[model samples]
Target: MIETSEQGDVAVLTMSRGPVNALDLELLTAFPGALSDVAGAAAVVLTGAGRCFSAGVDLKRIVDGGPSYVAEFLPALSTAMLALFDHPRPVVAAVNGHALAGGCVLAAACDVRVMSGGTIGVTELAAGVPFPTVPMEIMRHAAGSAVDRLVLTAEKLPREEAYRIGLVDELTDDLVPAALARANALAAAPAEVYALAKQQLRAPAHERIAARRERDDPGVAELWSASATQERLRGFLSRLAAR
Candidate 1:
């Protein structure tokens, strides 16, 4: 699910699930471990194989597996996301293509996001699911004023618009090189100091997540498992297939 390679001092982790690299339970469960595998690198560059960074949660899996699967999946999703968010080393997102819903949240959790050609946004509402506390907090921290439109409208903004809205730190066609350069630049700082400063900057969001996750996550999972939500997701899948 993840392919790890070394590019000089930077660890490059590529999501290789293929097609759109949708986040399923297996992929989510493997992600944190992949991060652990690269702990020795000075920095990390995360991207996806083929044309997509990720297309977000495997809603088809959710619709097919029902509530039991949802109960198991949500926790894994949170774990993977938090692992990236709290990684001690700098992490850069090399968003090569579509990053929607959970995929957008994953990119948002990174230290710097460099994009080439991609559309990015959160479309959880359109899927008839509410954001889990972790994703909500990350989006709040990254998107600022753009969060409302992203969450509520569920529009996938093109690369230029995404850059304008501050969703991506840099826009360049030389994705991996630009992302590697930025990651290296950030890694130049004292590792311990950089990690500590990052933790401090993200402390507010972390605190909010710690405070509300226990209460909020279960409700979010329950909603995702609700029959109406499943039906909506099925409809969404159909629409996607039609397209």
Candidate 2:
């Protein structure tokens, strides 16, 4: 589900899957534990094992479970997302490819985000999915005024455009090394102070997201499972498959 490489006090997390990392239930279950295990790490760098960061949530799983199942799973998912926001250490997202939907949320939740030259956006509109209210709130808090294109449009912004929109901290051909270097620099700070500072930076957003997650998650999950979104998603994927 996740591969962790420990180098001193830094934990490098790689999501292993296909050409694109797909967030199935296994990945979701494994994610919280991975973050927990790296609690004491000076910094955390998150990346994909293959050509992409993550494709998003596994729709097949949702389809198989039927629409009603989303509600049961959402609370855990919300917690998992919030955990990254409230992470003790700085979490850097090293984006290797298009991050759509949940993938974008994952990146947004990180303390900093760096994208490879090949990266793109997997906007929810393009995915034929509505932005879950809770996730949108998380994005607003975590990404600040940046990354609005990801919310309003379904368009996939290439690395350059992502940089222009401030969705990425840096656009580099060598994302892994850049992300690692940044992590190391952050690690140089006093560990206690760095952790506390990072916490303070995100505390307000975290609290707001936590409250909304508890209050709005059920309805958001139900909206995600709505027939309209499902049909649109199915059509979009089918077209891709046909292509």
Candidate 3:
């Protein structure tokens, strides 16, 4: 589900699940662990292979016996997200296509995001997939004024608008190279200082995510189990298939 390769001081983490790189339990567990194995890298560049960066969480998994998965998966997902967000080295998102909901949050958690040939937003509310605490924080931190528009409307902004709203730091024809260049620049900072600066910079969001961890995860999971959301999830899967 996750593939890692090293290029000099930068580590490239590619999300390679078929069709679109949808987040599932296995990916949730493996992504963060992969980072640990590549701890030597000064910076990490995360991207998805094939067409998309990621469509977001695997709705099939969420709707199929979703409650059980959410019970465990939500925590795991949050842990992985927070781990990437709090990683010692700079993390850059190289988004090649539509990055929605959890995928957008994953990008948001990173130090920088470069995207092209696609849209990006947090569409979880519209998709009937509930948001975990950490991902929500990522959106608020990264999107700012765009949050209300994105969450309430679930609109996937175009590349230019996405950049205008701060959804992405760079919008260019070249994704990985732009992201890697940014990562290389960011990687110049002293590792310890960079880590601490990032922790401090993200402290508010991190605290909120941690604080809401106990309270919000279950509610989100329960909503996933609800008939309405399950029906919505099914619809989402169908739409994805049709596209």
Candidate 4:
């Protein structure tokens, strides 16, 4: 599900689950281990194969597997996201294409996000699910004032608009190169200092996650498993199929 390569001191981690790189339980479970495997690298660049960074959770899997699956999936989702969010080394998101919902949250977890040509937003609400604590906190930290609009409206903003709203740090046709350069620049800093600063800056979000996750995540999972939410998910999938 993850393809790892080296670019000098920077480790390049690509999400390679084909088609849309949808976040299934396996993919989510594998992600943190991939991050751990790249620990020797000074920095990391996370991108996706094909035209999508990721399209978010696999709704078909959810609909087919029902509550049992959702119960397992929610924790994996939070763990994977938190792994990326809490990685001590500098991590840059090379958003090669569409990053929606969990995918957008994955990108937001990075220290910097560089996009070439794709929409990026949190569309969890549109998918008939509420944001789990990890993603919600990450988005709130990365997106600043735009979080409310992105979360509540569930609009996938185009690259330029995403930049304007602070979701994207840079927009470039040369996505990997730009992202690598940024990662390299960040890696040049004293590792401990950079890590400490990053931790300090992100401390509030982490605190929020710590305080709220235990209380919030179970409720979120229950909602996802609720019949009404499943029905809405089915309707959302039908709409996608029609398109």
Identify the leading candidate in terms of lDDT: 4
Per-residue error for 173 in candidate 3, Å, reads 1.3
Query: What's the best-to-worst order under lDDT?
Result: 4, 1, 3, 2
lDDT (Cα, tens digit) per residue for candidate 1, span 134-206: 8999999999999999999999999899989898999998999999999999999999999999989999998
lDDT of 2 by residue, 1-243 (tens): 689998667799999966677776667777889999988788999988877788787776666666756665565566677777778777899998878778878888887888984555646777666655556776786556764756776666777877777777887788878898888887787878887997787667667766775567666677778888777778777877898
Could you tell me the C-alpha RMSD of candidate 2 in Å?
2.1
Q: For candidate 4, write residues 95-198 as lDDT tens digits.
A: 99999999999999999999998799889988889988999999999998888999999999999999987789999999989999999999999989998999
Assess candidate 4 and give its lDDT.
Answer: 0.94
Evaluate model 1: give its TM-score. 0.98
lDDT values, one for every candidate: 0.93, 0.76, 0.85, 0.94
Tell me the spans in candidate 2 whose CA falls farther than 4 Å from its real position: none
Which is superior by lDDT, 1 or 4?
Answer: 4
Candidate 1 local distance difference test against the native: 0.93
Instruction: State every prediction's TM-score relative to the real structure.
Output: 0.98, 0.89, 0.95, 0.99
| Candidate achieving higher TM-score, 3 or 4 | 4
True-vs-predicted CA distance for residue 180, candidate 1, Å: 0.6
Per-residue accuracy of model 3 over 83-199 as CA lDDT, tens digit each = 888888999999999888888888888888998878888888778776778888878888888788888888888889988878788888977778889999999999999989988
Candidate 2's TM-score: 0.89
The stretch of ten residues in a row with the least summed lDDT in candidate 4 is: 118-127
Residue 198 accuracy (lDDT) in model 1: 91
